[model samples]
Target: MSSPEQWTHPEPGEGPAARAAQPSPEQVIAGLRATTEGGAELTQLLTPEGERVASPQFDRYVADIDGEALRGLYRDMVLVRRADREANAMQRQGQLGIWVPLLGQEAAQIGSGRALRKQDMAFPSYREHGVAYARGIDFRELMGIFRCTDHGNWDFKAHGFHPYTIVIGNQVLNATGYAMGQKFEGKVGDEDGEATIVYFGDGATSQGDVHEGFVWSAVYDAPLVFFCQNNQWAISEPTERQSRLPLYQRARGYGFPGIRVDGNDVLACLAVTRWALDECRHGNGPVLIEAFTYRMDAHTTTDDPTRYRLSDELEAWKLKDPIERVRAYLARNGHADQPYFDRIQAEADQFAADLREFTFNMPEPPPERVFANVYAEPSAALDAQREEYLAYLSGFATAGER
Candidate 1:
């Protein structure tokens, strides 16, 4: 039996009926809802209706979190949502190439993000905007990559965050290697030792690189946390297509523990992540967390979800909106008032405006910028491409003179 503190992860029921039943494309509209013998498959701290529930194991981790911390978490979620909304709007206005919106995953990102110690590093996939926010990354610097101006102008080491990795599951290898390096440097098995956290989506798990990363991390007992946001869809493909069992179960095969948490429940995410990171620092690492959540928007601004996913499904998830539940919890418990909520909205508006202004005024990258890192000594191919680009640009200028 599982402890009250550690909510039991319900296994898929066995038998002929279970074997005969497979969720079809039509059933994808079922909103990815699954239940366990214990009630739900996920460990939840807050319900969809804004009610706070007790979890002994997770609650022990967050015992010190008071009303102020709860309010701060709410504020973080609000600001992140605002920034994401602004980014989407900017993309639609042609100010950006594309945006991978983290619309419904704010709790998943922010809660886990805040759990990291200063020495810990986080490796992000393309859509960890909320995590970037939690790291105190200047929103201005983060937008440069999407602006087509600079390839992430922020300092990776200082922020303890690497540049967003676009390749599927590639960053998992990078994070694993970094964690191994930390172990080599004798940074493991201590409260002050560094740890590594890597973010990858459900889709990325299908890639061999992620599998290899799992093997390496487990074998070495690297101080690492694999935070997988199972947002139902890996782009257009549902997570149903990616695994024979729940994504969390994969951790067992690698000789580590895995748990599923309600991604929308920020308190659970924070407590769970804190415990996991501590476990890593104490040398019981390479833990996997499957944050079960839904993506409320299209994969990117360029994609339309309507063609594949059902509207009803999106509506169903909306009731479980991460921000709303946090807000309600705050209000119901008298942790925050209406005036405070208003102020947050006002602040979010200002943030969006400021973000928009800076984004619009962002300077274009010079042609030479692309070839800057081609070689320590300039390569012939790079020089040729640079010269050709300059020549082509000049031709347009010359034509204007005529």
Candidate 2:
């Protein structure tokens, strides 16, 4: 990671020579007004006050989702938020060495996750806790890696969710390759269908692998959706440091449609994700969705936001709280009651307790366990190495034990 000073800064007035020559004060003022009043439609279907806004692209898709379905989406956000908070608490309590909190991005993950079909495959980066929850993965399983007790406790093949990829943008390539494989396997546009969704953060977008993934997807016309969660900060580095233009525009350069959606709005996320997946399934090639969101917590348990950010900014984002917005919507529309909210809280608490118990009792893998899976077939050299390691451990025992 580079120091803040080393990061790029957008030159406010350093573009085309013709425009730079002379801009009257009046022209500059007009330009600023136009920018503020008219730009792109940063797609949003849900407001911070929980009112449903009109979005032509998504309105038709969400029209059939009844009140019950809306409530279910709200529930998903609540439970996922609880699990996220518990994970953070556990990390702080020393139960785990580290944690990456998905504190404010529940709507983005849940919306995208719920939109995914059973046949769809998801490739996630490390911070996608909500994505894991939506995919039916036990929250405890996620803790295993951070706790250093296990290597991917869940079955990736069974769940259609890849194990969390820690390397910044590597999963982008993996996802593209997987989608390309799907194309080769004649899985594209089949009546029996599937598509791939790859998740990465704004920080990852700066990596070469992410760009390569986009190029490959475009060249192959692979069925993949590159979901970029622009969570404002990438471990203290703002999105501006990574790119001058919005991340979504990068996709357009690669010959695919790029969209910027309000990631904090669950309805928009689901609607957009569903459309992207359908486009891929129908062999429309790749799509990129820039989910404009904010990471409300520290980058991870080890991170201290105080060093680089302001509390006032965080407080501002709180007003756009993803879970609270949905709850407000539910309450205002009479889709949910006090009992419903209470039950959701209770369920969340139970889940946290269960996770605590499971993590506490997680068995440590034996010393020899490390050697067990080193190779598919044991070699003579490996057998000798294992024997030497055993002897080394034996040499440190008490006299009687030895």
Candidate 3:
């Protein structure tokens, strides 16, 4: 098996710009944002300037949700962002080995995650902290994975959110298989039909697993929604480096409907995702939603994005920040006051504080914890290895002292 550093992330076979001979990051993102197809515009509800645009198709999906629900969504986003920031801080403070930051993609996660029904399941990528929060999965559940103290400590089935998949594109297949099972069990074509949603990034679309997942979902007509958080960059590479057309277009080729939404706009994301999920439940499923957003921080704690992207790109995306837009909209329309903002801020602080308290106090898993989940029954080879490991540990009298 290949180590993490040895994994080959081959570029998403060159687009038209590939022949242009090593374009700059700015040039790459510019081309990626262009209309590669029939000038399909991104579906937007809230603009960077805090304007509320009308989307006739998606408006009705959220029309029944009143101002109170909007306030709760905003509050959820604030707390999620605070938790994400704290997770990054934990890494910097040496409490974790690494953390994948989802700084600017808050709306994409919260919007889709909140749209899920109790019966629906979600398969997530590692940076889905916001989605985890929306699904009521506490930050501590993710801490184990980030800290390297445990691969995963949460019960995914219980939470309706699966364990975060570190291997890119793996969750795509997992969700597809789960949805296929739901189909085999006859969960489709009804108002209460169960659906499955899988989350991945623009980068994962280049992977074979994602493509196969799409094919399987389409072939089986599984009640599935493919949520792609196209956060512009897949680590150091931009979306254009992954595909020539916007990611949503790929769904059409697999014989399913696809749509692109402004990932930074919470309302639009919520509406679009709700629409897609409903379509899945009604048996017209296997929908693809390309959330057009940007990753505002390093891919992970160990990466330095400044080495690849320009300062101007970051500045531009900041104006369209998910939380800031909702906050601005609420204030503009008087849905919330300064007191409400202050209360939400306090709640967010408390949430982050609890996260820190729990993660800091969580006991590190024992060395044997690694061997416990390898199999359902005793394995002779693993048992021998475990004995050898214990014997090696006994050789050092000061092993536990550290």
Candidate 4:
């Protein structure tokens, strides 16, 4: 809750020297186990059991989410999860180098993703397939990334979704700078103002680049939303190992308001993100949202989560599955029936089928393609190197033909 104007040096013996009380190891473990329940500050509009919960402040943001809109959100999560699972399976089948599964965090990604305006930009860490889908990026366009065939070739300007950043929290720096540029260009402080949202995992908070981004964005009042999906683990490390306090609270020290949300609840994610984006567009700027969710799969296809965690934890999270809650709500309210659910499942299956077919048919890029876009402007040196490489390749082909 602290702001930049609130900063003042503490008196001697009243700051860090006071030695705040640290929680015992047992207390830490208890706290970690209880995070699944989402603490009191969490902004939630839907319960795990599919019941609707009202929030006086956030409800107005999602007041337009009638049955049709709710159904659309449900469909988004279903298709995204289906594509993610298919990608994961393809990796095991040797179709891709590796895959980052977005299995349990669908609501977190899709809800926040759908909340963005067309003018808003998004920067993502590698595991944001759901967000990409919501941004209108073809699922097939992403296949090349995991297959190691193409660096993302999508039109970022048109889609407002940047390329996936693989180096942990590196995208945070990129987004912060971009948001700063938005401020510099006088693109903020109006209803039509632009904002940027950067997505990273809970583990990324440990990286220095993320902290630097927080400081820079805060200082400039840049229109950026720091969306942290706290899926409970950074590969093998639990959340407790990452930070003593809930990650959202860290925003206070950086002079911004941070809020925790029930990441498993799509309605909550949408409402909170819309609110954050509204604030940024109006120049309040640089809010942080910690999405309390879980990751049900290995960090990547290459990771073996079984070596570090137990099945019991996975089972506990399964009961809170993001998709099922929406499905339940739809059915219980008669907004959708079994036939509707069946049609959606069929569509998701077809989506996966298309993705698989695309991967199977993907052609290898020519060697020269690597040098094609190294620079925006022409470079004689790069052109000369490309010609040399192509000539080398041609020599081998001619020898084979002979």
Candidate 4 lDDT over residue span 1-402, tens digit each = 121111122234433311234544444445545566666677889989999998999999999999999999999999999999999999999999999999999999999999999999999999999999999999999989889988899999899999999999999999999999999999999999999999999999999999999999999999999999999999998776677568999999999999999999999999999999999999999999999999999999999999998898899899999999999999999999999999999999999999999899999998889986688899999999999999999999999998
Q: Which candidate is the best by lDDT?
A: 4
Model 3: per-residue Cα lDDT over 1-402, one tens digit each? 111111122134433233434655545444633522112468988887777888779899899767789898899889888998998998899888899998988899999999999989999988898888888887778898887788776766777998889899999999999999988898888899999999999889999999999999999998899999888788898765566566788888999999999898898999999999899888898999988888989999899999998887788778788899888888999899999999999999999999999888988677777887777788999999998998887878577677
Report the Cα RMSD per candidate. Answer: 4.5, 5.5, 6.8, 4.7
- How far residue 261's Cα lies from its native spot in candidate 2, in Å, is 0.9
Please report how far candidate 3 places residue 320 from its true position, in Å.
0.6
Best by TM-score: 4
Candidate 1, residues 56-137, lDDT tens digits: the string is 7889988888889999999999999999999999999999999889999999999999998888999999999999889879
lDDT of each: 0.86, 0.82, 0.84, 0.90
- Kindly report which residue stretches of model 4 are placed more than 4 angstroms away from their true locations once superposed: 1-25
Which residue pairs does candidate 3 place in steric collision?
Answer: none
Please give the TM-score that candidate 3 achieves against the real structure: 0.87
In candidate 3, stretches whose alpha carbon ends up further than 4 angstroms from where it belongs are 1-40, 371-402
**After best superposition, candidate 2 residue 183: deviation in angstroms?**
0.7
Per-prediction tally of clashes: 1, 0, 0, 0
TM-score comparison, 2 vs 4, better candidate: 4
Angstrom error of the Cα, residue 337, model 2: value is 0.8
